[model samples]
Target: MKTRLGCLSNKSDSCSDFSEFLPPAQETAARSLKLSTDEAEQWSESFDVLLSHKYGLSAFRAFLKTEFSDENIEFWTACEEYKKIKSSAKLVSKANKIYKEFIDVQAPREVNIDYRTREKTRRCLEDPSPTSLNEVQAKIYSLMEKDSYPRFLRSKMYQDIINRTHAKCQRRSV
Candidate 1:
């Protein structure tokens, strides 16, 4: 099935070659949050750890390029669309369209990877009922509050694992 992140959920199909971008275990829990305002703020707080420090923004951009396939094409398209759109609020929308319509479709091989990433990201925020919320939240928050880039990158696989755990918890709660 197609996942929100535009990747296939099946584990067999790996995404791109940028496996080095995997986040650390401690921070993976927190870094996998949905691409929302809170997540952005959280990322911003750890800008050093996320962007300028190591493979932060560069890694993210690389992953995005792999996920999207054609880097500049879509970004430029989004930029153009963003300019055309009368509403300032549509910037994200324009960008998303650039991602979903152009980028996602351009690369079929990476769809599964995108889906996996999406599914994993969703799982990070969930918990089984109210009981595990504290634990899950704490797990992620702690990682975000502390930790270095190298330490986090070493345990990148945990990002997907943590996502699946959250998904399980959420399903149990539902």
Candidate 2:
């Protein structure tokens, strides 16, 4: 069966009078997708391929009609609004995904021993002390002027030295 697409004759000088296929939703769809400028142009070509395959010459002529239509200006304007809405939706979806991951992996903070070791090393450098307990305390107090030198060595490595000093102090007290 032969499809009669649009009317065309020598009587009408303007080409706007003829149109008999789907109006260009290609431009509208591309803009609504909020594609980049380069992407939009590439999309236009792809849209033409799809339309041409679907409707052939009839769709091609309809595209010309849209190029000169005053009433369809609103259609193009609506496409821009659709683009904004679609872009915002994508951004919101991405944010929600990150928030969900954060909630899923929520855990309590763990005490970091590496950080503690580094702090202790820095203190030792600032206040170099002798191997003996009394000399170490005197150096720590004289150099840094802080109370309770025994409490400063709280890590497991220094616990034995602190225990020995406590025993010595206990014997002297007796």
- Index of the highest-lDDT prediction: 1
Pairs of residues clashing in candidate 1: 7-111, 7-114, 7-115, 8-111, 8-112, 24-152
For candidate 2, the C-alpha RMSD (Å) to the true structure equals 39.0
Q: Candidate 2: lDDT of 30?
A: 30
TM-score of each: 0.20, 0.14
| Angstrom error at residue 159, model 1 | 19
Task: Supply the TM-score for candidate 1.
Answer: 0.20
Which portions of model 1 miss their true places by more than 4 Å?
A: 1-48, 52-55, 59-86, 89-152, 155-174
lDDT of 2 by residue, 15-77 (tens): 222222334455333322221223212323443332233232232334333333211222222
* Local error of candidate 1 at residue 52 (angstroms): 4.6
TM-score of 2: 0.14
TM-score leader: 1
